[model samples]
Target: MKKVLIPKRKLPWGSDHEAIIWLMAVLLVVGMVNVFSSTFITAENENSAPYAYLLKHLISMGIGFVLFAMSWRVDYHKWRDWLGPVALSIAALLLFVLAAGTVVNGAKRWIYLGAFSFQPAEFAKICSVMIAAYILSYRVEHKLPINILNAQYAFIAFLFVAVEMEPDMGTACVILGIPIVMLWMAGLKTYKLQRLALVGLAAVVGMCIYQPYRLERIKVMFNPWSDAQGMGYQTVQSVTAIGSGGFWGMGLGQGLAKYAYLPEAHTDFAFAVFCQENGFVLVALVLLLYGAFAYYAVRIARDAYDVYGQLLAGGIMLLVVGQAVVNISMVAGCFPVVGVPLPFISYGGTSLMMTMFSVGVLINIGRYSRAKQAKEKLDELRRNNLKNHEAALAAMPGRRRLQRIK
Candidate 1:
């Protein structure tokens, strides 16, 4: 008798996963090119090699990719077990930064180790998301109440206050916003969310008033031209760069903004340099890539295998895309200059590595979800085939006699 053959089931690739990888790759390339273009003049003026910033950026990218791979290989569910230690470590680091971090432009937000610096607040953002995911998922599974006085809220507040003391209100705002958004998505009561919103608003308002510089930023945001050469200088320059790009741009490496015309052109205002050099057409393309990223990120979260995965992906999506929105708006004069860097495009080692790590976790969740769905599909196919075979046997002559003989 001839042997019957069955086909092996193959795991399916998720479109969302593929799209995310491509989008990230494109953004990274854009970031590399822009960083080099925007910093060579400044590097030369500072008595450094023209490619100094570019080389450092390349090193950071290399390290970031390695971290991305490691994160992608780890099981996201295991993060629940590691949350406690990670949160404690982050808390310690934040305290250390406040005590002895490197000061730049009046903010103590970095810890210098030799030639490299680390930002605890970036990791703080990651910890905030993980804490919310673990606690919210546990509450949901145990059928417990979603109280506002849980460890989730405590950790978020701790991170917020620590980062705020770094005087990085931009990062502190982001840390606070991440968990509140996650809470709402996890089905917290509307009244509770509203209350949280009001408190957050009050905190932000008080913080602004406490710092005279922050209030000055708000005033300059509304009328950058009023103080064109003072507090509003950066904003005015950024808007001018963006507006001068017009439809076709000034061409690569040909922009005047980097000639001592715009401060921090390669860091916080990198997007402004990009807009000035690449024109409105490429700007639109960059925006579209960000839009596509958000779309696919939402799809991944929606199709996640469990609640924790859903919330994890959702929080990360909000972090990356929300930060991008705020950075772009700040550059375009739609929002105050808050020192928020554009993800993947800004030239900061700590920010780049942490962003890539978070994205890797998201991709791993997508991969697991895709595999689960494919396995379910394959099992259903096998069951249906078995049912059809049994029905055929029942309809055949002497089916009972054949079954008894077997």
Candidate 2:
């Protein structure tokens, strides 16, 4: 098959249409400071340079920018052609990591490559969105009968199964939920979607009961004092860090929790460190930035030129927003200890790159939407001018005939 060349248009970088970019930039800068505060102390105590932790995160940010810029240059619609293969590659990577991954804190989620490690689950979240967007776009185009046993739904279920078996339940849920959102946005009826939701709620309940660890985490959430120094330690530390903030934080780099008190200060529980170091005010600012990002993403999805672009942007919006909620909930003690990281803010290279890439796609959708609107306005004006010109030409014929007769 011949490849189609998607013409690239120059986008106005300073336009308000790109508000998410500004929000993301602020979040990224704040995350760098928080990661440094959380990780540098530990690195320094171990005779490593204080900037070692900061350097790694900065490097991830640099790489993420490259991915973002590259993604923006391409038309997101092209992915529809081979989203299946892309998704299969991500799923295969998930399985591969499960079999030959680096074991850290009893979970084999990381694939190490020389000096750095990457989490396949992180990229899988974005891939799930891409796959779902493709399938939903196809269904909407063909007006397929999408019942409970639909093949597209089954295929999406398979992706969820692979992710869940990896034991990364949080990411698995995000991956599954994003597609549901995309399907809804693609014009699925509410009653049909409600049935899916009911089933999802049942599955959540069943999983909590079946998985002892998940149930234990729930118990720990309700009564942090019960386990104290056991399974509940992370929760207790996180709560204490939040409570200690008290309107204003202990100040950056001065958080007591990072001094060997809180575990996973740079990864799963990074938000707790953020709260401890930056206080409620800065935390509020971060939340505001997140809200802005969500708002613009939804706008992009709403304004996209076609169903495919809309679904793609909408699916990605769900992934980022859903992950942020899960990560923040884990930190705020509202949910069980799910090891999900804040998007663009966490100290993981894979997560950062995937998120930035998704943002870049949304930017492309916004650009296309704007361009299409401009073209429509121009066409409308041209049509109006042609009609007026035709009226003038008709009147001129009558005048000429009258003058000739006279």
Candidate 3:
């Protein structure tokens, strides 16, 4: 008998994974450069070292990279079992933030831990996706109906209210938007979805009216120049910086807007500063990177190994890309300023860490999907080879004659 050897298969590393990794690296590098360029003047004005904010951003990036590595190495399925404790811990933190969180810029959204401040709402957003993905995937797996009255909705609602109470409407809206998008993707009935949409709309309107400033922001979104020095000040400055970049930009770190002219130049409006310093060409390139990210993320989601992975990847996609869209629109004066930070470009430690963690999980899912596909291919190949070997044996000598005689 002759020995048969099956070809060794390498773990598949598709373009989707490569694209995501490259996109993240490029965006992080751009973010680091823009963070320094945008914040140096502000740091000097505060009597701090010109590199102060850049150093802090670097520290956050280091922590985020650690998280990303851990998430990529761990099995994403473990998160399904840990959801209960994770949700409880996040809920408690949200409550604690409401009670005694550090106040910054009139928003009590952070809790100080040693030298670092933590934002519970950021965790809540990712947790909400996990919760929704787990619940919906479980129900579908068990052949159970996905009712609106499930614990997933309850927990998400609680998170939304807590974040809103923190007076951080931008994050609250993001928290709310995550599950709704997931629910739709989960194949909820159209009627239920419509009802949910109506309720969401009503709640948004009520929340806006509850805060007079929110209404003002909405009005200013439509006509920012109506009162340029009042509610529209940030919008006007953001637009000016973006437009001033012209075709080639004013050159990095040379933009005049970041010299205390535009508030939150390093945080919420980091894109504006980047546009001002890098010009339309670089802005277009950056936006193309984001667009490519979204495209590859969608590919990963659609090709996930199972229903759970699909939903999980889809939720993460919405979380990152959706937030980027909202932030860019707000900065462009096309939407109300909701203070949402651009994903990798924003200078928030917790946000950058959580986002990196989510991307890590996504990458893990992609790896699993590829592995499963490779295993399937190997199994099919083995089966086909075995069939061929059996046919050859039967065709040789008296194998078929022996069977006929029997």
Candidate 4:
């Protein structure tokens, strides 16, 4: 006799997950507006069309949407197999960038193609999370803290250091930190984890001291007025732009700071332009949306039926929230301007694509959670129905022993 082949099962996205995707879409729309606002004055100075930069960003956004849709359709679990190869490919690209990448403002962080550029560090981040999740899923006892020097963890650290050599500090930090958090959440050893963290900190400190620009950025952050016209100009202008908006804002497309005074107004400092035009109210709303997203991501982890799914959800959550903190901190002058872009709001093709891919993974995790819950609900219903049936049988005369069957 021939046996029948059964199809593999997959999960469906939950309501909250779908809501977050919509929120991301809304934020992208708002981001486009700010990108356009930041470009107008600069384009005028260069004799370019009024919307040249905005048009380019809009085009990128269109591409991002297509990638986002594709990601949503594919199964994230397949990445477990693809993670290693894709990561190796990305690692090679980063190495290539370090050796021959284009330099923009002293950092060789992009692989350029005539009119387009791609940041490998961006994609490397998501890949790191997926790889970390795959490695940590083997832990049998889910505890707290984790050893950082294990072969898998060390690989993650090495990958991050390679990205950092591209000298993308913000991406490097996130790439390294997110995996550590995921591993810790999956269970390891706390005292051992602390030791590795201290060593990592010392290494980072040494690297910072060796790099003049990185050191200079740190100094300027501590004292923005120290070099008001040089290293400090960006932060100072950012503060002014955010401050001028007050509580309500100067109104959309009416911001004075975008008149060429605030550098990177549409990219790294896009939040400032957003705050300038939309005020604290809208900024708070953006924060709320992010908070909601973070909340749902955690929920996905908590509800995941298996260890891999849990770690994957947690790692993705950490990546998004961690990046948000770094971006906002730079704009707020709490940290040095490390060139991290606001997710869904920054104007870059590679950044947008990677972010959407992470969202796709999170959506996949949500699907698993939904499937697990549905299965549990079905099992519970079956148990209840079985009990009811037995109880009804027990009610029949001479059926007193039916309760034992349950």
Models 1 onward score TM values of: 0.93, 0.91, 0.94, 0.88
Candidate 3 global TM-score: 0.94
Candidate 1 — what's its lDDT?
A: 0.91
Task: Write candidate 3's Cα lDDT for 1-406 as tens digits.
Answer: 9999987756333468767988999999999999999988899989999999999999999999999999888888998989899999999999999899999999899999898788989999899999889888888888887666886788898999999998999998888788888888888889988898998889878987899889999998999999899999999999999999999999999998888889999999999999999999999998998898899998999999888999999999999999999999988999998879999998889999999999999999988898899999999999999999999877777967788779
Off by over 4 Å in 2: 1-16, 397-406
lDDT of each: 0.91, 0.82, 0.90, 0.82
RMSD of each: 4.0, 6.9, 4.3, 7.5
Lowest lDDT 10-mer window, candidate 4?
140-149
Error of 1 at 324 (Å): 0.3
Model 1 worst lDDT run, 10 consecutive residues: 6-15
Runs in model 1 deviating more than 4 A are 1-14, 394-400, 403-406
RMSD of 2: 6.9
Q: Between the candidate structures 1 and 2, which one is better when assessed by lDDT?
A: 1
User: How many clashing residue pairs, candidate 4?
Assistant: 1
